[model samples]
Target: MMEFRMKRISRKFSSVLAVISIIIISVMIFSYGCVKKEEKEITIGAVLSLTGKGAKYGEAIRRGIELALEEVNAEPNRIAKIKVVYEDSLSEPQKAVSAFNKLIEIDKVSVVIGPVLSNEVLACAPIANLKKVVILNTSAGTEDLRKAGDYVFRNRESAIPQAIKIAELCRTTIGIEKMSIIYSNSPNGKDYQNAFMKRFEELGGKILQIENYKDGETDFRTQLLKIKESHPQGVYLAGLVTELAYILKQSKELNFKTSFFASAGIEGSKLFEIAGDSAEGVIFGSPAFDPASNEPLIRNFVMKYRQRYNQDPDFFTANAYDALKLIAISIDKAGYSSEGVKNTLYSIKDYPGVGGTTTFDSDGEVIKPIRIKIIKGDQFVSFEKQEK
Candidate 1:
């Protein structure tokens, strides 16, 4: 009886061990099933200022990108839905680099949209090149950024065209033989000043004086007074709209009545709002102006922007919208692969955009139309359109 009782106890213990082993195997299988493997998605990244001095511009760009994605997703036959992630660069170089690193290394985005400022773009270029991520810039116009890497692409014309346009205007329309340059000492400003000076001198235009103001400096009365004393035939303001407005208002106050030919700084409506009547008659180089442009895409975009934001789309916003569409089109044409997209984008020739027909050269700088716009009665009126 003792032996039989011991045998029963052993059988029960073995049964319990078997049950426990079965449960352990089941749990292990369930956990293994629940473990996530690496999944791939169509990822794109954007680095915009969004919250700093250039917030308005950044917000507009972000809105444009969002709208493009919304449209692409709404299509039933869409190739593959893109997942766009954004980081605020604050228009700073280091921050821009960090944003690029996060997008490339962390998010694994195949394509990147800009750090809008030229300096920030330049800072982020090396990283994009190293990571083999395609970068498309909407607004950074520094000539050097275009040549930063083979993967770098831009939708906007650089300051060189604007400088040449202004030089032509100064020589012909304004009848200015001698001119003075009042430029902010930022990278973009300095780039515009240098390009304008070089082109103006090349065009046989004389430089009466050149003055530089540091960025974020509110006081330009001293600069205005100096420009006034120089008595230039025309004054080229090479800065963002804020500084340009200050210079214009101060020029008016200081009785400096030199006809102004500006760079792309005066492309937005905010310039007119900031400078009021003082902004009138100011000729600036722009990509194109079509309050009544016939392009259906532009018309649709303008209508949508007005309906949603209750404001007209500026050149920058238009460029941003086109930038996203260009990327989308490239991806679609390339069959949703990174190499295909890059190769297709490089192969894109004479792709018509809202701004104009854009063709990427060997260096990826977009060759497109550049226009000259004159501010007339609180509106930008196109004065000239040069087709490349």
Candidate 2:
């Protein structure tokens, strides 16, 4: 009996040892810079809304990422051949968490590019911090991301910068002292509305009324009626292209003659396609990217993007291209470890990107110039040019 008990105990001890060995090996490879020279390729994960409501943005972003991937692989001084594994987030929080777990566990990726929406970032950022995985957010611009731990870094400016700039422009430039806000009733939309409201109020503007609508709602007539009744000098919209386009179109149908304003993220060609002439004269703030730019970096990126995608790169595409380029640069400079990537990204200073100069602050938020843009005829032109 004693001999049999000792045998059982021995088996249990060996099992525990095996588990520990596996964990130690995992930490060495993933947590620390213990990559082998023989390993020629490193896999990174991307969680994006490949399908569902945010699909348009995802497709545009995918184009930029693919272009960058081809360039990265063909570089003569490349660190390692990089592969990006993508999972559909469906633009939902729970789905994003699942995608993140699968990437970190099954795919064993130390870095991930995105959970495209702001709420998705809020959902996955905790796990990113706990697991020591790096997140290079492609386009989620809520202010809350500034506190989303060191592992989270953004490729684009947060809604705070653009929101603040738009509010200032509305007050100082457009001379609109009162407006009404229509925003999506979600994490991202709420953040954008709140930022703009606070700034506008500080500049002595009165928000006649505030209204929120659920995501995926087609008809915004009811909200428009309420906003129209408020009789504000202008109306500020904060939501996706699908919803915002409809809002602009319906506002015109209702004959609500107020000027229209929006956030940077809403600048997409689809808006013009949907709203037609209603989209003209709408003002917003953006992170200074001009497809017509004479700058070599901007020109090259625009040319390549158009040649490959057969479409002009918008805000989403510009950020996605920069995100991939930064990721490759980070890996080359600081190995494939998560900490190495995080530290290197944070250390970046005024790195000229197609989007703008990218320099991360202490909170991992990108520092870039935000300029106001106006929809004129069929283009987003610099508002300053009109002033000049």
Q: Highest lDDT: give the candidate number.
A: 2
* lDDT of model 1, residue 168: 74
lDDT of 2 at 81: 89
lDDT of 1: 0.80
Which segments of model 2 are wrong by more than 4 Å? 1-39
Off by over 4 Å in 1: 1-41, 335-338, 384-388
**Residue-wise lDDT of candidate 1 within 1-388, one digit each (tens)?**
9999999999999999999999999999887754522122478899998876666678778887887778876766564677789999986789989998998889888888888888889998888778788888888778897679977888888888878778876886656788899987777888889988887788788898899987667789988888788878888988877778878877887777878988786666667666788987888888763646867877887888889988777777777777888888888787655576678778888876766788888888888877787778877777654212
lDDT of 2 by residue, 87-204 (tens): 9999888999999999999999999998888889999999999999999997887888999998999978888778888888889877999999999887778888999999999999
What local distance difference test score does each model get?
Answer: 0.80, 0.88
After TM-score superposition, the amount by which residue 298's alpha carbon in candidate 1 deviates from its true location, in angstroms, is: 2.0
Task: Candidate 2: give its CA RMSD in angstroms.
Answer: 12.4
Each candidate: how many clashes?
Answer: 0, 0
